[model samples]
Target: MDAETLPPHVVRTAPGQYEATLPGGTLRMSMRQEELPLPEICDFALRHNARRRFLFVSRVLGRHMPTRPAAMQDVASRLADKISIDPADGPVLFVGMAETATTLAQTVYAAWCRRGGQGLYIESTRRPTGGPIAFEFVESHSHAMAHLVHLPSPEDDPENLFTTARRVVVVDDEATTGRTALGLVASYAAWRGIAPESLRRELAVLARWMTDAQSTESEFTAFHSLVEGSFEFVETGVFAEAPPAVPHPDRAGLARRGTRHGLSHPQPLPWQLDVSPGHRILVIGTGEYGYQPLLLAADLEARGAIAWVQATTRSPVLPGGAIGHVRSFPALSGERHTEFLYNVPEDHGYDRVLLCCEDVLPPLEHPIHHISRLEVLPLPGTLTS
Candidate 1:
């Protein structure tokens, strides 16, 4: 993830302040740019949480942006190629940070499996499953601080995916201070009664922007990423706060659908979307219910459409960095929280942008408000999550 001479992507906006030129617009921010090209991978945004004045928003993570499914697969495959484990290596478990990195982690785990690596994908969630709790950790900066790690037990791990596990690989979008990842591994190590020095552990991310998050001279701990470097964020303490974020979905429908509890494969709803084949299609998942959208994308691809799945997020970011564009509209969750999609093309972004939601159809004027060539296609059935 280290580069020799990447061009600077951040520009000084004002005295002691900077702006990242994202794909969409100039994101006003202040960062002491380090050796890394800050805007190439991500940009800064104001956070609703007062403790953390800014947020390192990613372009390709698809949380605040709409990204192609194949592109995500490409990233996962490329990352899989980088992670190597000898057959003699112990069982591995990949932990994807919930809400943000769940899908990304699953994508990498899927690729890892294709590469003949043995691993189970478990993610930390704010939602409680009422099942066995493996361990827990804290992300102090996140709006949702509490995290639950649900591990598979003897009955679920017939293959000994848990018992034989000696390695832990944590995946995330970006590493700001690296404390979260380090803390997670430390907690897991304590739970297993093993010293952190006893096992192989690595923190993987798309961008290594945090200086503290960078790799140091240690074999016991390592950091890997698609792009690695550092940026300086000089929070002016004058940024506007985003509106309150809706808490993680906990509706009975979403819980039954396993929105929070980790899923090897999201249970598919027996429903379908009708669209033309062979076209480059964009399917938008409303809110955090993205698994269903991915399933829909796979089905569309199988039906001859070059399909990709992306979603609107409750998280608000000042546009820029990989965020070429941002589409702001009311969400279909019936919560009235603002929804956003980043870097979607203007005219030719895609042949069609299908707004997919579980239940509570968006208003008739919603889709046309932000996107053209849009169709409000309801994913059949009373869906929630």
Candidate 2:
């Protein structure tokens, strides 16, 4: 059966009254939905990460035409509240996690920066084809071991961008254990010689879904107070653990379909093509669809194509030199007509450019059109062929 014809239990449900069958007994959730309007909190927690399972499937950012600026603002405002810093407290450095959270983090940074404080936006990325690296680190669960961060020169730093800025807001989609943020704090503290307690660092996310038992909030606080100085976290509602594994007809069918096609059934991307052996292909993704493109790029690499992936987002670029994980590329829209300028020289000269995501479209003036063979990969469920 097609995914759409699957049983109701297989589809995602709205956050409201719902019945779920558990191992020992039945579980139900009955609570009034409360809206949280903190911009930073929303940006970091709600929108930063993409939906992991079938339980949640909506994409919040520019994936749809009407970009929710208010949603972005709500997250930024909450993050500011957590830090207890005035919106005008100079420029704040906003660093986003890799892949999915890049745009969401960038939005929070823009909101924070627009409020009289300069905003410096940086996102983490695993693609290492081009761009100068200012720093590098490792993400435990990621397939890529090395993450490269690119910061602009000090000359490009905005008036408010400074290493000694009172607040450095670290934004992620979700803070499950707060370990990622804590690791970030430890890195900054060690580098600056500021006690974790003395270093004014704040953490924010779109949702604080992970329970305290799963997170290191208490441990982080204790470590900072004992090892350094102080740190704080601002978040929305704590999330409960996802429902235990229930039979998913859609996933199972997809798995079966893959085996028939000689593809790795239900595993990320089944169809992989080697554009050319040893040739590097860059697949750029849109906001919400970033992770899928990254996965496909990796799969293509495994199939013998040197692949690099990056994403374009709606977040405003800050006038600073501090770098984040993902590299900011230009979108094809608007008056500049310089969108193709952001394409990496090493990437543009590739044998193929497999553009993924439903929203990504070729530019009118694509530089690669004349140089390389371009192909489009339609996302599942929406594919006609």
Candidate 3:
């Protein structure tokens, strides 16, 4: 149906006995095989940015649930197809949404580099480390206001990366109404002092299951028309919520308590203020467990702690710094492995440090150097409260 003719909500079902409510009629989703002709560039973006959650049921990656790396690659490949850039022209900056999309965006960077492009990746964050912020924006739909993005060198020429790019591709897992992408693009455009038309921009997602064609059209018309550009989508997968699974040891305890706490009880931890009228708190999230920290941070803020939030991820940065988000972090296994280095920034420090993990213990070797205080909260299965 057209965008103007669609309803406010639509629903869909899946083979896993799950259902998804969309803007149109409900669609039945299953582990069925579907293929389409895609360019090598697009494939690269998809492979790099794809998440385990997006894999086909029969695929090898889906066999035991794909690694975060594999899923991230898939997402990146898909994004590459949406926007093309010329690296020799200038550097690209990639900005990823906090929490879920951090790694996916990083994957986009990786693909761009492989294509001989130079780029930088940054995600909106809430953890405040008492540093000067390069820029700040608002996420209208997010629970928190004030998203902070720190640029490496403010003195650098913006034209090379910000203005010279052929196009900017905003990456996300899904685009419901397209409001988030519009917000991001507008923020960047306003800050860069470049007309939105000066930069060709697009959006890439693994799924595009909006309520109707009209909804999609209206969203694009609202944003793209303002920016004076066009937009496109790749795999238009339907959205279907999975059925709840039996809780594992790591989550059972927290799940039970969460239910008792009214799903909003576990408040965010307080931020240690080092300066008066303290700066905003920015919590840099880690991996799939990042949401827990996000919720905790939000709770802390609700309880009167001044804090903001963001996440680090495995997504690659591409030319113009476009990338999807991914789930990757340094495992505290003392192995000195690659996966262990992703999120452990060398000078990383905070006023108050809070860590959330499943059954894993905090890495003792790291020695909470950047943090003034450290609090560790094990998964719900470990404690009643």
**C-alpha local distance difference test of each model:** 0.63, 0.42, 0.38
How well does each candidate superpose onto the true structure, as a TM-score? Answer: 0.71, 0.45, 0.42
lDDT of 1: 0.63
Q: Regarding lDDT, does 1 or 3 come out ahead?
A: 1
CA RMSD of each candidate after superposition: 6.2, 18.3, 18.6
**Top lDDT model:** 1
Candidate 3 structure, TM-score to reference: 0.42
Which lDDT tens digits does candidate 3 get at residues 183-294? 6666677777777655555665544433343253433322211011112223444334432321111211111112111110122333332332332334444332344444
State the displacement of the C-alpha of residue 57, model 1, in Å, after optimal TM-score superposition. 3.4
Write model 1 residue lDDT over 63-149, tens digit each, in one string.
Answer: 665555665666666677777867666778778886677667777777787777776667776555567677878887665566777
Candidate 2 Cα deviation (angstroms), residue 278? 45
Candidates sorted by lDDT, descending order? 1, 2, 3
- After TM-score superposition, what is the CA distance of residue 333 in candidate 3 from its true location, in Å? 19
lDDT of 2 by residue, 17-53 (tens): 3333221222232323224311212111111212221
